[model samples]
Target: MRASESDTWLAKMISPQSEDESEDDILYNDRKFSWSAGYPHWEIFGGGTRVVATDALTSSSLFSLTEAVAEIIKREKVTHAVLIQPVIDILMKEQIAIKLKKIVILGTVGFRSVLDCVGKICDELVNMYGMVEFGTIAAGSYRVNDVNTYKHKVLSVKPLPGVELKVTDDNGHLVPVGDRGLIQVRSQKRFTGYLNHASRWVDQLVRTGWLNSSDGGYITTDGFMVIEGRINGLMDVFGLKVYPFQVENAIKGMKAISNAVVIPIREKETKFCVPCAAVVYHPGSENTTQNIQEYIREEFAFTKENPIMASVYVPQVVVKFKTFPQTSNGKPDRHGIAAEVKRQIDPKKYECIE
Candidate 1:
């Protein structure tokens, strides 16, 4: 729609692996914009909508664009808004907690945008629209849990009446009440099919009426849905479940240890499973390795248990001029960090598992 909008589309088409193989100037604009969490420039796309851009969010000209949207929303009292948050900054988490009617998030895979708050508004919309016969739309199993939990989070499409809803777990087991699995719906209202693609949707549906969501979790023992982390993110620590987000959330509350990653490294001694976290200390704080270990033990106590043991040791905390390298979609790149950790520490000293 706008000249800057071309930049957003170009960014989407550019593959992450291709960037290293190409020239720097070819990938980005010379004009400095705080569009990304790092770097000199980032492209932003804005049409007619309310927007909120924080300085801490990213390094992109997006702030100027979002400011324009924010003014319009405040002035027009717009209800539904779609905005793309910067990659690392969880703008939805920040905004959902604030005053706004509803905001839809749009972004690419690397950006991995999420909608955190969707509480009361969904029910009102359902009441207003449910009576009218609507068509069905396909969604992952996690959507059921997300919708049930955030009952007020509204969706544009409603499944037609008489549509069958099925929920299952990752193991392909049909869960009973409160049990959660992948979800699949069958109804006449389902779309005719995909455009320019025929086989994409087939891979998602199964003969047993379950669609694999790739996200793992279960329905509540109380008939509610609970969404765990993605299956790809599943870390089998001696057969125990360990979620990186859970660990990161705990570490975020700690004093000096600002950010940490619980990477499975092979221990030299017992050859057992151990996690080594490469940490980033808070800016302008005197954070030594010993101080960080103590903080982990006292404040966010997650360690030494079956399935996993928390041998929380901060071998070294490197000081960075800014936040770390991020994925194209805006999420922190754990894979990239893991590679960096290999460079910093000997892999033989830590426990390593697939």
Candidate 2:
């Protein structure tokens, strides 16, 4: 290829977490390339068994995904893309809406996160892109048929053949539909056992032919699985169960915050411990730490109907970050972020939580 035709974008699949793993630059190649098939970068580049011409333009270090895509469309004469759901929110605002066709989201964090941003995606892109085929994947839980029309925009994951799903509570009892519980599945597709980690596999995964997904969810009347959060080892506050995603989504909804991550904060005085949120805000956001804390308090204010959950679920602190530290897989590094919070948090500011 000539220099003019060679402008492929290589997206960041993951980054190293620690200095010890500095030698390991987690990226895709011929062997591990299949893992990236569902991501935007792979769709752009990574030569494979594609019948169509999917010439990708590399743009890895950019802050705004939309901006990067915009450049690619202009330069590469691109017309379609298979992007993750999170990118659609920002991408919809750009002029690229008039270009793309398909929008496939590989839902690693569940389909609902994409669903939350679907309105903007459909409204902004659908009319322009001509009824875009936008959907997400949730391993064994969500399927192609699960993606429905706007009014019927609910997640319905049909368990595979010979896969029996069980949503059980703490004591392994079934909960009613729409009520959250541990998601256990006994499937032919499920792994029989780990290679050598017998104890770890038994303790964390397989139990009586059923695989504990370490996920929490509820089945709707229509057989749709509404994911709540991770079930294995969730963070707590004063003996009250709190989900990090719940708090993170709330913070992300704020006008000032562009991105958010909620992590477990270990406190000796607190009975169960507390939550700390590290956020990346919009440019020109005149938000102070007090304002951020106040916003969380108001958003998570206790309700009279059930004062317990709302009260305990609220964040004890919120910290600002230029960019959240990411794990090798491009996921938020909660532990690394927590350590940063500890370093930045003032004694006087956080003492109130105790």
* Candidate 2 error regions (>4 Å): 1-65, 73-80, 94-98, 110-164, 190-192, 199-207, 266-272, 282-301, 304-311, 348-354
Cα lDDT, all candidates: 0.40, 0.50
Writing each residue's lDDT as its tens digit, candidate 2 over 1-354 gives 000000022222222222333453343333322222223245334544432222343235324656776666658866545554345544543324434433444333433334433433332221111000111213322223433442222234555455567788876789998777877666444333333323342454444665555567678777756554454336667676766766765666566666677776655544346677788765556477577666666776755675556546666667888766754334455667777887887654453221
- Alpha carbon lDDT at 345, candidate 1: 64
Candidate 1 matches the true fold with a TM-score of 0.46
The digit string of per-residue lDDT tens for model 1 on 69-166 reads 55656688777664543311332322422235554432221111132334432111111111011122322221324544543111222233555545
Lowest-lDDT window of 10 residues in candidate 2? 126-135
lDDT of 2 at 136: 22
**Candidate topping TM-score:** 2
